[model samples]
Target chain A: MGGADIERLIALLARLPGLGPRSARRAALALLRQPQTRMLPLAQAMEQAARTVRTCSTCGNLDTHDPCGICTDSARDRGLVCVVETVGDLWALERAGVHRGVYQVLGGTLSALSGTGPDDLNLAPLLARLEEGGVREVILALGATVEGAATAHWLQDRLAGFDVPVSRVGQGVPMGGGALDVLDDGTLAAALTARKIYS
Target chain B: MGGADIERLIALLARLPGLGPRSARRAALALLRQPQTRMLPLAQAMEQAARTVRTCSTCGNLDTHDPCGICTDSARDRGLVCVVETVGDLWALERAGVHRGVYQVLGGTLSALSGTGPDDLNLAPLLARLEEGGVREVILALGATVEGAATAHWLQDRLAGFDVPVSRVGQGVPMGGGALDVLDDGTLAAALTARKIYS
Candidate 1:
């Protein structure tokens, strides 16, 4: 029955940022029933991704290689490093197009509540790389939450001995932002709470 | 530069459901920065799908063969046919696990407002299949709206002379359903306006 295949796909898709079982089912059905041209690319992409995707050994970014494309790109500014909590955060920063430096994906932010620490993150390797690679500056692009700031402070302290400039991406709404697509439930809730209703 | 490839991907992704330029850009950047697994699979899938996926000659459903798996399944009950407005609808019905017969996807519903008529849909071929094949019943699983009703009526009148049964799927809240996922603006607005509060 199509149920098994659908269930499997839905479970996999549910793990994606904005999707749940219902949405996953909707997406899977769309792929299954629509023109093959419209959906085959996505399926193939998913299939290939499942097979090959792994964490970058260098920057902790999701990649097929140990060192990601950014790490491997010779033209990129290796001296400048942009530090981010996760791959998602790194992607957001990249889309902004302001950063020309290579990234250091921490894999996760420091969180006492979640029991995440320096050892758990890929920061030591980043520090080792920094010592070897003449990195001049490190930019921290973290969330505005207390935990994010705490992590930033921790990171600054950890790199205190090193002679490198550390900066943080400014907090506020994304500058000159266009309409956001696919506002997932959490973002939607945040937006709703932020909204000022007309009289 | 990776910019052009990122832009091309963003354009394509922007057209997908729930993706704007920002999200598309983010997704594209994610792929670009970590291309080894992501890009390779996506490219492979795109190429393979383009080569292999085709429409079922009998039904409009996407398939590698002329007749889709449902149409060709020997164990399926061909005597009864469930007619749906879209292949997506057919998949929805299938997920509910209520229907046992095969399906006939209309591709779209009849809409006088939108100027969609017999020619615009795959209705003619459906009718032909009904007449030529040993089909005894047709179940209408279209939305319970004006266009859905009109289409159902049109089909009923067209096949009035034939000795067969025509029925509609149940309306109102679905079983195991709460707050339908990522509904269109119109449907979501309507649902919000029509929602009932329980004490």
Candidate 2:
């Protein structure tokens, strides 16, 4: 039905995170249908990104520059650093427009089953940043999962020697959550435990 | 959080059939993570397909060659031509491996609401192929929709001038479909109407 090139394109597209074989084929066909407008531009963009995009040495964020924009930005508070498990999490925080400080991407969390230890993450650079001083506070914004808790605990133990204060993001009912009846047991418990007093 | 190239890649990817902005960003990040293994090869494949693929003049199928591999293949029966609405349909039939005949891709069906007409389809090459003679059968393997029926009727009216016999693919219960209770009214009607003779 198709030539080798088209077959290869479909196969490669199938390797992406959400795309499977059928969807990849559909995407390939959609791209092929408009070669000049869609396929060429996408190919050029991918090529350009592949050639230029690199990981930031300071914060483990991905950008074309070594230090990344957030690391080099003077306006953002360097004294307050938010530690996230992945770049995706950092992007999520940035999208929310709440964080006015820099980020340290751990790349991944520690997992016993996956054999991911503290060394597997970007902890060395984070420690180096802490050792350089001037950082006033460190915020652990990791997930609510067991691996996230384990990673945060390990980081807390390591950062105890430093002069900077460490804190974890508050856990409770989310901003747009529904009624307590619809909430899960863990979330309900967290919300009850972390309840604030009325004025 | 990303540069122009990465943003451009995400935007372009978001235009694909099943992907949205968030998924596209995930895909872009996945690609960027392994530039050597995933991104470069996909880019190269897209470029190659874009540069080499062309529409087959004879059958309207996409291939690197002029007439396409199916049209030029001596093993397939040239006397039986399966007319399909798109190259994707042709690929589907080919994947089934039930058809020993060649194909004629109509590119799209006739639609009054969308302003698609006979002139907009690949009817010229089809008529030309019929006029060249030796065509025993013309099978309409279009979708089971109003547009497909309209297109089939139009083709039947046009092929009235030709000597070849025109037929449509059967409409009935699918291969792996469940009981009659689960089937929709249209499909049930189709199945009952097209019921075969019991041995």
Candidate 3:
């Protein structure tokens, strides 16, 4: 029936995380054998999501509506804004359900290796929006990579004297446990170098 | 834009392979932020594939057509049939590019725990198909699990006194491996007991 079609399906699935050609082939076959009732709804969902989902014009977050629900919401604190390198990071913060403010997705961090810079980031617009909307605090929630650190520094410099309290998210290993085995050698070294004596 | 939509998107993406709520949330955010050209086409492809794909009536493979391409192919060796528990397994064999025979999908192995049996499987239909066709051999490409072994034995008993030869796929760990170092005592013992002298 759909030899070429199945091939196409496998190709698409292979692109997803943790799916190699072997697993993709397997998943496709399972889908093929499934009844229409099961398959159709999934298909519809995929179509609907694809057709309607769009980015928030204000903060570069994904949404079906402009400005997004968070931005439009009155309950959230308008003065506190979290800045992240990607929309994915924003979603993670959202799922944690801890933050009460809106977000600014920078699209990506400044990377010297990748030729990414301050201007390349959509930060100017975010800054402008902050100024226009009277934002008080900007929380940088970027990855703990070199690029991320560089970006945080860049943003700090850019927003200097703007009357906004710029704070970077905590870096290094987790706390309140035994020795941090998960912390990288560099972070561990840094932590050791900046260690404080207990009373 | 997609504040409420984030929940729905996360749920949907979590259902996909290798994506937990954490990963799904990230993916949704990524999609929301950029909505790039790559994303639109990928989404469209996903939708189109989902909309058209269906099960093959003759062989239980997924396809846009009813009989499926494999079943309809005149060039394939229909007499040498490979029996598999799932369409996914069949696809794995196809990916290996080793076999040129048609396939018989058992749907699942017999499991007393799950209350699955010969009747629960498509065995009757398979037997009928065998009777109606020119099948000379049935290759069991089932898993190495206990149920998979029992199913093979059951099939052997059912096809007693038949002319066709029943064979199983070879059992062993994949290449670039040594279980003697990593396997538990029981599995290592079993592997050693079942070891064959390869020339």
Off by over 4 Å in 1: A1-15, A25-82, A87-107, A111-139, A145-147, A163-199, B22-53, B172-199
Residue-level lDDT of model 3, residues B87-111, one tens digit each, is: 7777667767888988888889999
Pick by lDDT: which candidate is best?
A: 2
Cα lDDT tens digits for candidate 2, B1-199 = 8777778999999998879999998998899999989999998999999999999999988898888999999999999999999999998899889889988899999999999988889988778888989889999999988899899999999898997899999998888887778878887898889989989
Model 1, range B121-161, lDDT digits (tens) per residue? 78666678777868888888887688987998888887776
Writing each residue's lDDT as its tens digit, candidate 3 over A1-199 gives 2566667766765765556776666555545455254334445454566667766787877777777788889999878889998766776788679799988889898887889877788776577866786888999898878898888998899888687889988655556646778667988876777677999
Candidate 3 has which clashing residue pairs, if any? A1-B68, A1-B69, A32-B62, A62-B32, A63-B1, A63-B2, A68-B1
Give all candidates' CA lDDT scores. Answer: 0.68, 0.91, 0.72
Write down the lDDT that model 2 would get.
0.91
2 versus 3: better TM-score goes to: 2
Clashes of 3: 7
Query: Candidate 2, residue A32: CA error in Å?
Result: 0.7
The lowest-lDDT stretch of 10 consecutive residues in candidate 2 chain A is A175-184
> How does residue A44 of candidate 3 score in lDDT?
48
Model 1's alpha-carbon lDDT is 0.68
Screening candidate 2 with a backbone cut-off below 3 angstroms (N, C-alpha, C), the clashing residue pairs are none
lDDT per residue as tens, model 1, A1-199: 2333344544553443444567655655555554365566554544455445566777777665557777888988988888888777876666667788888888777888899876887797679977896899999887767678888999999887787888876543343555556435555555666666799
Q: Chain B TM per candidate, please? A: 0.81, 0.96, 0.84
Best by DockQ: 2
